[model samples]
Target: MVIPTFETTFAVPMTCEACIKDIEGSLKQLNGIQKISANLKEQLVSIEGTAAPSAIVDAIQSTGRDAILRGSGKSNSAAVCILESHAPHVENKVRGLARMVQVAPNLTIVDLSIRGLSPGTYHATVRETGDISEGPESAGAIWEAFKAKEGTACRGVFGTVEVSKGGVGTVFLDRPIQIWEMIGRSIVVARQEDGKFDKNDPDTLVGVIARSAGVWENDKTVCSCSGKTVWQERQDEVGRGML
Candidate 1:
């Protein structure tokens, strides 16, 4: 099967040609990368590849710089889910984030990142309903269409994310699913025990997938509602353990 490649842009801090060279050099070491372009004046790096966005960000950060995704894929093809735990005892409920981009008609790439969870394997799935009033239990079962189409025992399963001892996990997955079908659906991430997730676990996180900006779709650095710059918003997210 041929994996489709798409363009993704990131806002990086670049002051001179050396900065671009460092980032470009780092990205070249990753697999599935086809092309790399960096604009020093704009402080943006555009990459054409099948690599996960999270992986690309990590690579750039390795050079002692932060990389924020500016846009990805085509118009209306990107989605985001901010996973938050409903556990009352947890101070910071925002434990994870999932970014989805439809690179092809039937293929979507998901960048899943989780933190502040027990060190263990966790499974993620898209539930039939987005209703999280009662948490994951109220999210309904896995979408039936996935089972029927993929012939998998459990439907809507994206895959597993193995949390490290530091309470962090990251996974990049490409599934034969469309981004539009996942919109308004709830994505659940739960601790896996004996290879199965316990629905009753209070630490389970759930979030509804919502459409995000595509390439060149969002350009404003300051938010109108919060009156915060993009960097400020990022710092706030980091403070809440969303990084």
Candidate 2:
């Protein structure tokens, strides 16, 4: 019987056409790779093959680049999408992705990536309400909320991520919050246009917002060799609403 091929995608940091060639050349060294397609503009690579996911990722990283396994079509414990702003927003394109990884019963790591934003100071945070469907507009009230609270920081402020001239910034937040608490929440990216944030100036508000990622069905079934699998342990913790 012939083994069926599987598909996997990697979120790579590719700067140019040369980077695309490097990825193709490195991955070709692996056996059983049937097809490969790379999009430099999006920094995504798709591969259909029988190779183990690890081997494929290693190959890409071996070329002196970073790679994050987005998922195979079947399922994966993450969500990703390009960030969008309403009309009349800045011209720069923004891409945002959130991923959850459970490191311990009480600890979950939330990885965030934002690319193609203006090179300057920006704040990334989670909000009480705001769905991906409404985009950043859903978080417009966040500014007023900050003013009402008499604080410099907005509500649900996670942390600050710096975007360089290359237009890339990353944030890693480790919290006891469960995966369920994260999903369906809004992630807002606020730009400090005048080098300072003023509640009085609506222009100092956010431009991009997205819903955080969530876990998939198969993510809970991969555990082995234990009384309670990792996923089960996390689910138990989630029920308690923290850690």
Candidate 3:
């Protein structure tokens, strides 16, 4: 749910400043996040720019709070509308991130993207946005083997690089690399050619959203013998069994 100025509102339930801080912190720390304007009083947080609402919900949900996407820009739309949620847009930002693992080895790209997209909506946007991937380049590797072409990184002269998943290319025509934060299993996403998710199918988004939060279908089992889900103990047992 990214839009003009990358602002997507969230309908959340909180009790104190700590609550707000938690939400803000969780949302802002994502890979692509740039700025977050969270309001606990309104029980809402307008996540500005290039990120996804799924990340917001996952963040709050992980913290034991319910998070629902309201809407983007101005409209008489429902606060928890899924219309835009299913529009054709950038696929999961972390889909092929494992391939780009060497891009920022030190930063450890998490499934968080709210920090790099706080300026405007990704819909119809044609310009690069943030310097979210300031990892090795900042550290100065100074690789002279083949220094990139014109605009291939966060400091490129042209626009930033845009990741496309399940759609067309939506490269920002003015910047360098468009950074996205992939949270734990929670993935930060954007639109491909238009920053709009698959609007024709809501089910698609649902599946990925759940997967993004480490949720599997139909109470799947991580522990075949005990019929329990995988977490720490199960993982430890698996490791021990192999030993």
Candidate 4:
């Protein structure tokens, strides 16, 4: 099968040609990468490949530099969600993040990452409603539109991720769903009990999916709302364990 390829751009700290060479060299070792372009002036690296965005970020970080995904896919084809725990007394609620990009009409790539969770298998699914007033219970059931159209079980199931001993887990998945269908929905990640997810689990992380910028769609270096540069915002997100 031919894997679909899409372009993703990231903001990296590149000072000179050597920095670019180091990042390009590391990415070249990964499969599915067809092109790599680094701009020293813009501190941006654009990659065209079938590799997961998380993998690409890992590769760039391996070079001792942080990589911030600036944009992905075509115009209006990407979305993002920041998963947070609504459990009582949880000091730091942000637990995970999900990046979604529609690479094909029916294919959306979801790059999921989680930290500060117990070491075990967890299931992720898209809920029918974005409401989380009562946590996962209020998020409604797994999206049923795909089930009704395709005559299958709930299609909102995005499979599972195995959390490591260090409380970190990451998974890259592609589902036969469009990005538009997911906007304003809620994504929940929770530990399984008896091989099934329990919506009442207070520890289940939930977040509302919102549209994100596609390649070249966002170019501002400063945020108007926070009066912070892009790098500053990145630092804040990292400090909140959103990385």
Best by lDDT: 4
Q: Alpha-carbon error at 13 in model 1, in Å?
A: 1.5
Runs in model 1 lying further than 4 Å from the true structure? 145-155, 192-202
lDDT digits (tens) for residues 82-166 of candidate 3? 1112324533221111111102222211121222222332222112222123211111211221355655543212222332343
- lDDT value for model 3: 0.35
Per-residue alpha-carbon lDDT of model 1 for 33-66, expressed as tens digits? 9999988777789999899888999999999998
Report backbone clashes per prediction: 0, 1, 56, 0
Per-residue lDDT, model 3, residue 220, is 32
Q: Worst lDDT window (10 residues) for model 4?
A: 193-202
lDDT of 2 by residue, 1-243 (tens): 233455667767789999999899999999979999987776678888666555676699799986656565343333333344433444433355554443344444455666655677776665556554444545434322444456454335556778889876676565554344444555566674122333322222333332332212333323465567444655553343211
Candidate 4 on 133-197: residue-level lDDT in tens? 87777887888744555556456888899999999999988888899999999998987412344
Q: What is the TM-score of each candidate against the true structure?
A: 0.91, 0.45, 0.32, 0.93
What ranking emerges by lDDT with the best candidate at the front? 4, 1, 2, 3
Q: Ten residues in a row with the worst lDDT in model 2?
A: 212-221
Best by TM-score: 4
Error of 4 at 182 (Å): 0.6
